[model samples]
Target: MSLAPRAVLVHRRTEYEELIAHHGTPGQAAFFLASRGRSVAEVEQRHRRQAEALARAAAAVPLDWRRTRVERADLPRFLFEPEDVVVVVGQDGLVANVAKYLDGQPVVGVDADPGRNPGVLVRHRADALAALLPAAARSGARHLEERTMVEAVADDTQRLLALNEVYVGQPGHQTARYRLAVDGEPAEPQASSGVLVGTGTGATGWCRSAWLERGGPLALPGAAAPALAWFVREAWPSPATGTAQVHGLLDAGRQLVLTVESDRLVAFGDGIEADALELTWGQTIRLGVAPTRLRLLG
Candidate 1:
């Protein structure tokens, strides 16, 4: 007999939970929020709604199939099987957070609060999972929309993937110093805020902001394009550093290389700062299009 497909639901911690975690008690959390002119009742309501949506999604799972629930913070430690259908329930960012860990598994992005949240990535309604789950298990390829991803390889050892963008900078967004090279070109030393490399899926985010502020000829890539865009933020000209090669495209056969000249630098993807790679001086990191793509289901 064949094994039934598994549905893995991915979610994040609620604001109320976070507050309580930090403050150690609901009363303390409420007091802290009240001091900031916020109401604990609002947090309670949001948490209640999220719990209801999660329950509904879980209830929709077919009895024949196995089911699992995971938190966003636990994704790095979670092992995903090939036959598992990944369902992310939260804001658009949650989908991005989960995409990097998946191989080619079909992802259903469920908008937990559709009325209040602008869900560009999480587009499906919570109630639609009942129908969507079976269809996805049966014909995932037909409904799949592939999105390009960015990969960073450090010293030919550690590798990190991103659904949206990779941030290479200091711990606190401080000005960083590094030597950059693109497509086998001469490396140029630079002093700036940091470097941001993103795929077409991330064009509407941080990459878009950088593109608007600094004029670049190359537009962001589309979802299915096998290309990436890179921007050097606030490249300050100094006697030791140059700002000439700051923005460009990273298509196939091309790669962006950064050598950390600072005492320490951190590289993270999909806005997960907790799980980041630490780079020291003289460490080289390469950024390019990853071989794997995110198969997002509509």
Candidate 2:
């Protein structure tokens, strides 16, 4: 006899709480905001709303399942079991943050303040979770949408997955130099800001901006497509490096390989800068469709 699957509620600290944490007191935080002409009362109200939303989401979890709450900053160290169901209560970025830590778990994104910050990924309100949870747990439920994910593997060891995209660049937003190759084509040296490898879920984000700039005809992949898009940012045409292979699609059975030419390059997923992989000169990183996909509860 197995136990009921655990329900993990993921959340992040509010702006008011962060301010108080940094200033060590509410008065100091208020003063800091007042000095900058920001409204401390508004911050307090937003925090109150977030607290209420969290309470509602937690109470809505099915009584048969074990429940746990985790903060966003602590996601990397949190241990997730195979049978766990992840529920993120925040904006769309929170969903992306939790996605990297999960391995095929069903994720439900609960929008805390739908009126103020509408999100594409967070399609459900806190009040809807009562009915959403049970349906999500049932087998053969059509409420789940499988979102494509991208992966960055360094030398067959360090691997990082992203629901949105992976950024391989130099620290401090400086120029990055690397050798790029698509599929098994000959690698070419590239000098630019960095490279962005994105999935269908990320097409509307940074990838969309790049695509719009290039004015390419091909559309980005959809949610269920098993493909990836690559764009080299500001690829410089130097005497040594060429811009011919700046952007392309990585279809199935194909890969985009990048060899580090800079002294040090960092790879991070989903805009979480703190958690990253360091690649030194002569090291290679392969980017492509991840083997695992995110099962988003719609």
Candidate 3:
């Protein structure tokens, strides 16, 4: 009977101490871990080890292997629905995606601080479903870890969280230099070639790499936090193509524009490139930060 009712376990193994420490009761919390991606032999080995570890921590904790509990469940339709806390051991992207299933429940990342009783949480850097959890603007959002769904149901403030980064890259030449306007001011790339805006969260992903490779400065636009806009470096090898098949845009601020100048380019959502657009210039495309964030339990 944790103060938070029930918690959903996200990691594969270990970190059970945190769940036990935070739990008001032993059997109140439910756990789930991903064992699908691995081979049958690997999964079995990992599963046995993790189950033993968890069982030792809290004999009451129920380990469910039904629904995948991911951006999309990978395997095993998780029998577990939603829980109070979600402990994430992987990166922000995975955490953020997992956050979606919990309906914005308190997800903590395992960046546990010194002597924090495993009660530490890493805020997500990317992932829309995660960022929409809650905001500092809302009173309830402040006291996160202790929140229960019943107490914080009406939450609607937008918090932008990106694990990787929100980028607008290019495709023409091996490198592309474009003019960036912060609030409509000229901020061009000097040496490395493109410009990107990043939040502290985004700083962890692409923007951070850009910084390492001389991209540009990372800025947080709070007044318009709900929007995750990217000016784009214009990746069209050819030009703009107006087919939805050519999904990318050139965000110009005025009208959301899209065109096909035989734009030979590719756009990637999360470097996965599984979802990209063939983009061009002059067409104003819109890209804003996601309102939700990825939450994790450390």
Candidate 4:
């Protein structure tokens, strides 16, 4: 017999929860916030909204279906089944956080506090899950979408995926040294802060900021486009290094290859620097669009 479908609810700890965890009690959390000239009431209100949203999402799951909850921090250790229906009940970043670890399970982005968040990824209200979940659980559902993701694969076979952009550089603020070769072009020695390669899903945030700073002519791809854009941050041209190839686009099959020349470099995605891949000298990493897309519910 086929296995029953499962609903995996994903969320992150709210600010109030974090404060309480750190302060040990509500009174202490309030006092800590008051000392910093911040009001704990706002945090509490947000916490309530998050709880209400999560409850609504939970109540909407089909009674016969299996259900489970996974916090953002625990996603790295969580095992997702093929038939799981992911419901992220938090800010848009939480959806991005879960996207990297998923294979092709459809994700339902639930906006806990709608007006407060941009609602780019988490576009659905919690209450909407009542109807959405039923349709999502059905086989051959057409209410799903595929969002492109970027992947970074090191020469050692260490690979990292991101829903947004990937950063390649030193873990610290120090300059990074690498030889960059785009597509089949000749490699150019570069000394800069780092390199950023991102998908269209990430174009509006960090990728846009870098593109605006340099005002590059290349247009960023759309959310579902099979393409990626890359930018070299603070490329300092030296007598030994060049900056001729600063920013460009990577089509479906194209890749941006980087051979590390620094003592050590890190490749991280979607701002999760803590779980990044470490690259030593002479190591090479390739950045390209991943074959697996984020199966998001529309």
Candidate lDDT values, in order: 0.90, 0.90, 0.34, 0.94
Q: Give the TM-score of each candidate.
A: 0.95, 0.97, 0.42, 0.98
Predicted candidate 2 versus true structure: per-residue lDDT over 23-60, tens digit per residue: 99999999998899987999899898889889999999
Candidate 3 structure quality by residue, lDDT tens digits, 119-145? 223443223223322331133455454
User: What does candidate 4's lDDT look like per residue over 1-298, in tens digits?
Assistant: 9888899999999999999999999999999989989889999999999999999999999898999999999988999999899999999999899999999988999999989999999999988898998787777679788999999999999999999999999999589999999878999999999999999999999999999998766899999999999999999999989999999999999999999999999999999999999999999999999998998888
Point out the higher-scoring one by lDDT: 1 or 4: 4
How does candidate 2 score on lDDT?
0.90
Error of 4 at 113 (Å): 0.3
lDDT tens digits, residue span 1-298, model 1 = 6689999999999999999999999999999989999889988998988888899889989999899999988988999998899988888899899988988888998888868887778888879889988888885368878999999999949889999999999998998999999966999999999999999989989999999997656778987899999999999998999999989998876899999999999999988888899999999999999998998886
> Runs in model 1 with CA error above 4 Å?
none
Alpha-carbon RMSD to native, per candidate? 1.6, 1.2, 13.3, 0.8
Off by over 4 Å in 4: none
> How many residue pairs clash in model 1?
0
